[model samples]
Target: MSGSDDQSGLLVLGPLLRYVDETSASVWVETREPATVTVQRGTDSASARTFAVHGHHYALVELDGLQPGTTQAYTVAVDGATVWPEVASPFPAPVIATLERGRPLRLAFGSCRTSVSHDKRGNETHGVDAMRAWALEMAGQVQPADPDDPDLDPSRVPDLVLFLGDQVYADETTDAMRAFIESRRDIDQAPWTELKDYEEYAHLYALAWSDPANRWLLSTVPSAMIFDDHDIRDDWNTSQDWRRKMEATSWWHGRIVAGLASYWVYQHLGNMSPSQRAQDELYAQVLAHEGDDELDFGDLIDAFADRVDQQPQTYRWSYTRDFDTQARLVVVDSRAARQLDPDDRAMLDRDEAAWLDEQLRGDVDHLLVGTSLPFLLARGLHHLEAFSEALAQGAWGDRGARMGEKLRQTVDLEHWGAFQNSFQQLAHQTIDVAAGRRGRAPSTVTFLSGDVHHSYVSEAWPVEPGRHVESTILQAVCSPIRNPLSRNMRFATAVLSYGIAGPVGRLASRSTRVPDPPLDWHYAEGPWFDNNLACLQLDGPSLRMWWVTGEVHDGDHERPRLAKVASYALDADGNPPPREGTVSKLRRRLRPR
Candidate 1:
């Protein structure tokens, strides 16, 4: 049966390529009914029956025994009937290209997309969707080249797309989401604009991924994802006070349960490798159920999600992948893994921090640390957050602490800088790796992050002069794949990130009891507020990074063209050399269209 056949009771969401290795691959899909899903690549195929969760049916089919480094076209079938590639798929057919030994990794990473129509209204209000524009460009549908711009080579397409966080914003509902929520419940009630249940979340994912261009891109590109605060709520688990406030709400239990549960099925499950999936107790149960009858895991999954919410120590959301000898991608769970105790605020709890420390060793050419919240914020913002944390912890006194706590939540000062203890621990660990005290120092220790709705590159240096660190430590941030901060907010961000705020912030922190920072850093590229996506290319000893945003040309808003915002390169030692020009000249060259 064809995928579009309403009577087929077959595929609904995807035949999305998930994790892939040299010998195995995993494809995820949702169905209208419980059925066996199969993935075939050449003569080899793998099948898995759908498991029901609250009446929603899904399966992750595994394809194994593929040749290393081989690229093979794949097909999806539901209940022994071919369904995908939909006969008229306009783009290239989906394929699985396993990671080859010694091949340099090229990755596209971005965060924070809002689901809306791709018409003029949506384009004007939300800016064009960067992922959709890139996908169109990649598919050879739209190509606008500039003489000064870097070449757009289809052959060098990224092997994977890392969705850093905010994959779906549960708190900041789009108009379509609000309409869906209102259809089911009273709009005037508590949590009026936020998602309420697994049903709502499923609909949100459908809206987020269902766009034709993006859907095609996701089908072909393997994806890895993690959640940020917006995936549950704005400032989710920000502090002990925030948690207490949320817990007091009438619908919080339901919201948290649904958020975590939906995240597991839609994003987290696909993030795991085959071996990791085998180790998961819940997935093991799915595998152990051998009967032809469909398996229902609704109640069990609900209970599991509740348990995880109540005791996050029971689960591990962070994952690591090593790309042969090229690089190691350590995608961290920063939001859910927080320890918000007033006495000991931490970005990651002890267990999670320990796991992260263990993963920070070096052996490859580069180490990429992916956290939704930028590890190194603008220097000024870093000091401000650190100062806020100290005041919130009663560093000055009880009254000051109360005022600080209020300001902290109000201003959303809860990144790594706010969690001083955890930040210090990670900083020390990263320093050790860079200093070659832990392992063979890579060319660079790069922190890949988003969540702040702007893009930038920053380089950090040791506090002591003449400190010999072999690895270049840098921070790369790309955000808001579709969402854009308001003009007023952008002005505020620019002032705080680039102007007098740095010295002022340091003074503010010194006025409080906040300790001195372990290191220092400055912006190397930008603090640009654009709805953009970033590409990171590791080619042998060189690394290139660039940001691209969709720009409307000649009033053609519906078909926005991709435009380069800024580009930077790191030499063999991962150092971005300063350009020999005036600041005005540099700005003129890098400014967005």
Candidate 2:
């Protein structure tokens, strides 16, 4: 069913490995023809059988009766053709990693990437695709053998990967994708021949995922993804004005529907737990069917996509995961579930707001919130938010909306701060968890994000005691695993955002004309400008957050090397006993199940 006849080898899809109590694990793959999928442990093999679903070729290998807390090396065989590690391939094959139960969890996250050819120039420069960097590391194709090795090895695989958004760019495509479109339709026309419907979207998904190196990494890594603006279009749902302008176009209608539908198939479907999958109405129907019934899923997916767009609050896009007592991760969907009224706009709607409120209830030792956009902006930008909010509410005399217009044209009017009311609510919820107002308090609440193109961390401390608002909330942000901002703009954003906004914002709050006083905010960590990959290490009660970038400093090695751009640890929560303090405390406390 592919548009092209590029007969590449079979691609194995995931939730590849499983955690404890995983009775069955399903693996998906695309093949030339219907094929038999088999799984084996040690010398024993499960019966190989052809998948009866469509010859479009997908399989769900229900691997049952496997021991937990033990690693099992496995391989995939399609139509009796082995695809991975290519045996004579006892080559220390990749294993199905069982849960360690209480071991410290490692999660690697970042966003905003483009799928380009990874030949010599591209590979050596941009550090091979960010996803490839991780995969090659995993396959032991790169250096420094152990897990502690500071290289971009997929071998440095984490317990899970939380992809914060922009997994695909429907707006910007590679030369190959553009060429493919040009062959079919006119790009200089009104609809512009860019991602118009399900047919085009399917091709786009293939183009995005076909990179062999990156695809291998995704096959083995358990990934969770959320979509941002680029997944559908630029500045998606920035405001009512922006939305209205885009909706009036002929292409945007089909683009939005196809984008959401493809996202459900390619990304979100694999993210859900089996229990969650069963509860999914669309997926349930897909599972209940037994043939190549085009009528089965095609219509259902279309309707669902339309519903999500028309009624943003009807379906929730936020999900939470608790990693024992060590941490709880909440991934929010800031685009689709937005409340975009011209007078009272917000990044999230009321249903989404309520969902986030419930998810943020702190009972874990550490809380992590993942938003594609940072909750806290740079100082200058923070002041800009304050200024715009004041002007929009007519606090700045009669020229309020005019002032807001000027600011909107220049500054990014698409972040959490653009919707001041929603931002305020989120800040209060975050602070509430941090201040211990909610039952069990986490030692720290970190918001992991990307999408401003530069990476940095900032902290917010309590200005007023017991107030779970910006009065005492802290922030840490990192961005653009591969996309870096221009040097000139970086300097401008830093100086203006920090130097001027710091004083002006604080002073404006004291003007008495404002109802809710502005927050006392400052730059605590970084506006560290670079295109880099960020990793967070949470070993026991001690947490260290840092960014790593590939620098080509006269190295004899052809591959890009990772250098520590910035590093900081959060170990101030009274852990004792010198160097072993944090670990010792963590070992003593039995985590709640």
Candidate 3:
């Protein structure tokens, strides 16, 4: 149903381009009130009536019958009146370019952004937002002479932006979030600075995505997203002990419900293909409802979120998208679909693990695995986490186990390494695929990850001398599109990740009866703490990655330019050897500009 005249107020947040395929696209938007929204592409259009959850109105308009391999400009309207591309828009009109067959895909990805103003104060605190710099660069470029040109221009827009995790921080509430919370409830009361309910989450999203520059970029580029611990709380689902402790709290139920329900509406709902959305129960209800009235989904969504959290097997947040024969993007739900059983802790539950195993098979030239947590952390950190897990499980007797639990929680030693069984299973699967045992091996089996607050590239190798994997096994991490680690933390991370802690951790783990890892890896590029964004290009049999951050120039804080931090190129053979003097050179180059 489309609205006719009689709508009030501009859009509160987006007209974000979500999932896009060859013939269809999904665009999500938020409005100040209940209104029918429409997205128009050339002469084709799609419309949907807004639905209400906690008094906020939203709609996801699905555009179908789009031509493959064509770029079309689009506009958004509310209640029959155009609301987007305001009079004198600084940038070009928003567009959605559908993917074509047999084309190399270029994707940009990053994670961990804090909501703050873009003025001098905010830039000083969090560094200039790399996303804003990227958006500006894209805007400055003239329309490409040939859209399908593979190596056309570095400024040419990417096909999609994969936001791995921590899209918003519920625990580390910004000043704007805190102000909104204080206005509604007593600051001294429970749930204090963090978000308390769906209403607050709605506001937080507005704060995060409302900036005009980033908003326009989001509207034009297709995006896929997943949540990390900070989306609900720091160390969410860290362990059964942590889970029990949180469950006992008065506000934990409301927080989780709000977090998951809001995530479904704002992020996950748009990540699915039309066929996938058709199978969703809640989405089916949305489709069935008729007329112009706002459909209230608060109670239904709350119930759904509660059920999914309690029995994770009932729903799957993970999704796999195949881009013709070029590549396959498998985005895993690392946070929710976890087996926290003390005796058999795993990163993925039984059903989720089986699903991932199936998805790990190969035929395409490149296989991209998107998980919020990095699969292969620095060897030192990996060994330390494994040791901690073993000690927590009483590998060193009862007294050691108690201390281990405390240390685990304190140090946040919870990644793939902490869940030994799941890590080993996935490693074996990856090894098989890389060895061509599962299927035709891809040139690269690259793991795209974020959430560590720093960026780096690592390559894994089988331990045995003669054992060889045909495909390159790599971990590429980009984090904190706006947030940067503190100075002390950065120092510690560099010390540990650069080989100081590996030997010590291995010795400790040996004493604790923790088994050795099947493969060993090292940092090939960086442990840089700059707030940055990374772009990966897969062209034929080669994979290239480059990291860029915003750099202020000539006392101009607001208009920062994009500066390249580093670049790495890997051929079909595997990752190139690290440049001889790269460590010292990169450390100098990456210092805060």
Candidate 4:
């Protein structure tokens, strides 16, 4: 049903335990009407009511007066009706999970999934949605886990899910969305029959979230997401030139405003921890209400979107969370915090850069920086960006700029290297963290990324000690949870990048008397391309990263299975000495068949 068609219905987001503190935590959701949101201790009939809040569709039911390091079952009640089922699938309903000090965390993260029906396959081009498949298995519906293996419990789930980017595609709306558009507007228009207003965005969200498996997953699993280019449009914020072109378009303004505004309502608000949301202007207003009255945030949302598009520095697209002393996760918004000026271009503007620098703290066992696009591009791709940037600035003039523009338009080469200044700044930050400038050196400073339609891991060699250099760091990229790479483009990228780009970049850097990123800073742990899902586990001071994909044999019966595509582990010794060729070969052996 369209979002407008179903306004009065149950929408439960959490017993998701966000911002869990010594005694209280916040639970948030979007509901039809203001109702009494309740949290209980055990099952649906549990007598211990943790907390209750009234009126607001979004509730932060702070479970105050609770003991720490304890496990308790919780449920939500609206107007004396238990919203959560007594028995939840894959496990038990209102299962008791704990909050304790110094626990190991398992985080599942991926991006670029389209909202399609779980029932049918319209085209076999890219294959089924990897996320829905995974969620299905987790729900004990499609690919149920082994029954005899008692060690596996459905009640025990991952702590949080990190969605890097492209959670929804406004440009590539689903068939259902198209149908709605076809009924309402003309497809012969310039921008065609894509999303146009809040109504459309709401429908898009419903399609994205309504999948039973993913919906259940979201209800229990707290998730954090940041937008990418596709979340708005492909190659968004590539350069000021691109922005100027878009601004001249007839529909660009409404599209951007609607995109950002809907993002605030559908995604960004849920991303913030309770404490963080309190600082948000919209949420603050939401917090003040106490009846079943509709809290209209139209003005606030519109204003916030305008301010962000006009002045990105006013708010950061980055956030950091500490997983006790074990790990620190920093999710950065690469698209929003960009300086697109050709003269002084940087991936991140001053404010965002400074904020990111501050967040790259030390002393954590593992530091995970989640940038939607990998900060470290492939050697060949990196060279192309450098080459084009140089070419654009030199006597080549319009030709050079046009070449760069064409590459960005047809090929996605606009990454960290495109904005040289910001790349250098981040490089400095990585080097400093590795050199133990922040605090005790982390076991690994891992940059987790998704967006390139393939998965790979790269390691940056530490500048030698006592040689005025920096310590080693790593970057892991997992992409396109459903989108698969075409063979021709893959081969082209390989040829243009690794084969031709490297040597050219080196020669150009030396000839022009300009510094180039060190050659020692490059090595790939994977080149495995497929529609995939990646998981990372932290065991003590050690780190394990792997990618999985579904195997097909012409029928729908073969459900998605976890096949190891690539795996990387940081040595527990707290030092990543240049293994050089060692990790690359190992990764190749571990790659998916």
lDDT of 1: 0.86
State the TM-score for model 1: 0.96
lDDT of 1 by residue, 398-457 (tens): 998998899889999999999989888888888889898888988889999999998888
Q: How big is the RMSD of model 1? A: 2.1
Better of 1 and 3 by TM-score: 1
- Candidate 4 achieves a global lDDT of 0.67
TM-score attained by model 4: 0.86
Cα displacement (angstroms), candidate 3, residue 534, comes to: 0.5
| Residue 472 lDDT (model 2) | 23
Model 2: per-residue Cα lDDT over 177-261, one tens digit each = 7887888888897556456777666667676666555565555555677888888987788666567878898778788888887
Clashing pairs in 3: none
lDDT (Cα, tens digit) per residue for candidate 4, span 338-415: 887778788888888878888998888888999998888777677667666666555256776677677666667688
lDDT of 4 at 149: 33
Off by over 4 Å in 3: 1-8, 141-154, 572-578
Q: After superposition, how far is residue 285 of candidate 4 from its true place, in Å?
A: 1.9
Instruction: Give the better candidate number (2 or 3) by TM-score.
Output: 3
Q: Model 4, stretches more than 4 Å misplaced?
A: 1-8, 12-25, 33-36, 41-73, 86-98, 119-123, 142-156, 290-292, 463-472, 496-501, 508-514, 552-554, 575-593
Q: In model 1, which runs have C-alpha deviations exceeding 4 angstroms?
A: 1-9, 147-151, 580-593
Q: Per-residue alpha-carbon lDDT of model 3 for 251-273, expressed as tens digits?
A: 99999999999999999999999
